[model samples]
Target: MRRLKSVVTSAVLAFGALAATAGTPAQAATEVRYVALGDSYASGVGAGHYDSASGDCKRSQLGYPALWAGVHDEYQLTDVSCSGATMADVRANQLSALSTDTDAVTLTVGGNDAQFSSVVQACLTKDDAYCKTATDWMSYYATHQMADELAALYRDIKARAPHAEIAVLGYPQALSATGTCPVIDLGSAKRGYMNDFADALAEGTKAAADKESVTFIDVRDAFQGHGACGSDPWINNLSSGTEVFHPTLAGYIAGYYGELDGAWS
Candidate 1:
């Protein structure tokens, strides 16, 4: 009777050990293959820290893509976003990262193609009159040319990452259309033009996204009070070369990624 009792106890213990070993977390998280693509905003140029190996691409670990990927272990990210990437540049340099297995993609572009940054630079280097001409041209380009350009790019991305859900993120409002702050105080005329430029760009990008059946995430409202002229600023100014008009770390975390989190399905 004693020997039998001992044998039963040992068997019970062994079974419990096995069950614990194979317990609750039955399997690891399903791996989601994610690819980050597009220009500086996607690359996190202004967010400060960078992956030096990315070279001029300046892929920031704090960028919206990295932030989103970091929160969920399921996501495996390949960030290929680069600074100064035009639509053509993306097709040439970045699209190769995409494949049928790519589950998620986020892109921010078209501002470079429209020469929006150059307009800002003009206001800083030259005068509001020069900026006004540039802004007018940029607005026209955004309305007339950018939509079709973006549509073509979207189609190309869809073709490459056939299974991936792509979201094209639009830029934030860089300055409030009203008031003056020494930080970025472009006169009200230039500020108004910049605001119009943002509006035109958003319309074009959104139209392209709708036409292509991808999602377009507008960041304007998300960054409403954080523009240069606002109480708090999320965008960097002539403070640096590459980071000009780019988002700060806080902006990417709470603004860009914040809006994206809600849209992510």
Candidate 2:
């Protein structure tokens, strides 16, 4: 009886040791919280109506950020992009939207700061050389100034979301080379200005990202043939006189997916 009891006790001890050895320490899951900040493009202004549950800021789930989040379910997203948002808006106005746990961020801004819409509007209304020259000068100043602002925004995001991966998106071309309308004409000079403006914004974004060691994804080349001029264009035109230029749903999807593939992959 004593021998049998000893054998059972030894077997139980060995089983407990085996169980302990097989057990492993639990690993912390990779937290991927996405915080989107910036202006109309980030807000998805031209995409469609906003979700009332999200906020009154007109943020859309169909926006690139949301689309990115949808595909990458691991991310917890906080999209605070609004139409007409300036650099100051991101620094000062978007604090409420930021969380302590953000792991990634993306933004689109500076066009409004350059008053790009106003430039397009002016181009549509005026034909004089003086107007064109004045607009060109303004575009130059705005481009440089916007670079500074973009740098500032990058700094702010770093400060707020230290662990987050940052991506500053560039604006896509708004008009076709052939022009959207005969009446609301966009000539070669104007087209050059717009494209140049986009290029400047892209450069500015890159400079800012480089300064902070942030990952800057350049979508300009990706969007080249897919602009308003393409047979299957991404940008939208004023169907009548009311809607001048914006992105179509397909355009937004392309932009969103491109960014996602670039960033997540």
Candidate 3:
């Protein structure tokens, strides 16, 4: 009787041990990885609170990516955006930041390839006619010549990060629709022309996003009343000197970050 009882107790203990082992959960899944790749806009050149480690990339800790990462604790960010990164620059330097493990991406490139800095410089220093002509020429080139390059870049991004959800964030107009305000010396018409150039960039960017079946977050509408000439400008005025025409921290928070949150949510 004693031997039988011991045998029964040992069997029960072995079964309990097996059950406990079976009930142990698997290891927790890794956090989602997010990669940000683009130009000055993404680098937050004018947003202030620049990251100490970013060097000439001038990446701001207050930039939208950082803001987004702050809000999303589950995501790990790899921000490789540089201040003067063109589409080609992205191809050469930034794409490597992405991997199959990447789960999300945001891109704000193509402006430099369109020689957007030159357009802004012309607006700031040249006559209205010169600025207008240059703007028109840039508009034409962006719409016609830059499409293939942008498309290829977008496609490569998709290939590199196959499982990631990509978002192509658009640029805001540097000036309001109709205003003659502080900063750069341009007539209201020239300001309107600058806005038109913003439109051209948006069109090209949207085309690339569509090609990749990615989301295009248009900031123009949200930025309508907050241009450099508006009552409450979110963009840096010419008085900003080296950071002229870039978004202020307000722009990143209220404009860029807001739009990005909506898209992601």
> Best candidate per lDDT, number?
3
TM accuracy, model 1: 0.85
Cα TM-score per model: 0.85, 0.79, 0.87
Candidate 1 positional error at 84, Å: 0.8
- Model 3 C-alpha lDDT per residue in residues 102-163, reported as the tens digit of each score: 89999999899899988988877888898899889988877767766788888899899999
Per-residue alpha-carbon lDDT of candidate 2 for residues 152-224, written as tens digits (9 for 90 to 100): 7778777877777778777766655663444555667766666666666677667766777777777666566
CA deviation > 4 Å runs, candidate 2 = 1-31, 53-56, 128-131, 179-183, 240-243
* Candidate closest to the true structure, highest TM-score: 3
Rank by lDDT (best first)? 3, 1, 2
lDDT of each: 0.79, 0.65, 0.81
Q: What CA RMSD would candidate 3 show?
A: 15.7
lDDT of 3 at 206: 83
Better of 1 and 2 by lDDT: 1
Number of backbone clashes in candidate 1: 0
State the lDDT at 238 in candidate 3: 75
